[model samples]
Target: MSSTPALFRLAAACAAAALLAGCAVVSVASTAVGFAATAASLAVDATVGTAKAVGSVVMPSKAEDKQ
Candidate 1:
């Protein structure tokens, strides 16, 4: 679970949302897009954090590495 992959997903989602929103003329649609972007950002952050926490549990410590 690399941060790079998670960030790429977030970027792709935002791009898709922006592209899909171009045909609309309503304020609510724009608001929804904004909300979607926010949600995507949060989701990426949470996923990356979770992956790091799990890796910390499974990965070897510095003392183990030295051996």
Candidate 2:
């Protein structure tokens, strides 16, 4: 019957919409994770720089002894 084809079309459209929505959610999640990772990396780098600065102040390098 003609109604059966219309029902099939409606079902297909709903499925496609659901698939696109799921993809959008995944994209947002991936972006958030990437931002977090970048922020963490920057924090670690800053910590390391501070430690190195402290270390240098506490113990002068042997190269400085020649000067």
Candidate 3:
């Protein structure tokens, strides 16, 4: 089974938790931590998606073209 979806779900969960923590913690330090975690999670998700798209691109090679 592909792990990408599972990874996305996990990231989403992390982001949700961070948002909830921001609302519940109510301290400056905790709010900052929650925001940081949310940002990091989004960054990771974007990076992984970009990496997958880049990795999936196929370039035509001279050898393959001749076949």
Best by TM-score: 2
Tell me the tens digit of each residue's lDDT in model 3 across 1-67: 6899999999999999999988776787787999999999999999999987875676555677799
Q: Where is model 2 more than 4 Å wrong at Cα?
A: none
Task: Report residue 28 deviation for candidate 1 (angstroms).
Answer: 1.4
- Candidates sorted on TM-score, descending: 2, 1, 3
Q: Report every candidate's CA lDDT.
A: 0.90, 0.99, 0.87
Q: What lDDT tens digits, residue by residue, belong to model 1 across residues 1-67?
A: 6999999999999998987787565777888999999999999999999998998889977888999
Per-model TM-score on C-alpha atoms: 0.51, 0.86, 0.47
Which numbered prediction scores highest in lDDT against the true structure? Answer: 2
Q: What pairs collide in candidate 3?
A: none
Count: clashes, candidate 1: 0
Badly placed stretches (over 4 Å) of model 3 are 1-26, 59-67
Q: Which stretches of candidate 1 lie over 4 Å from their true place?
A: 1-25, 61-64
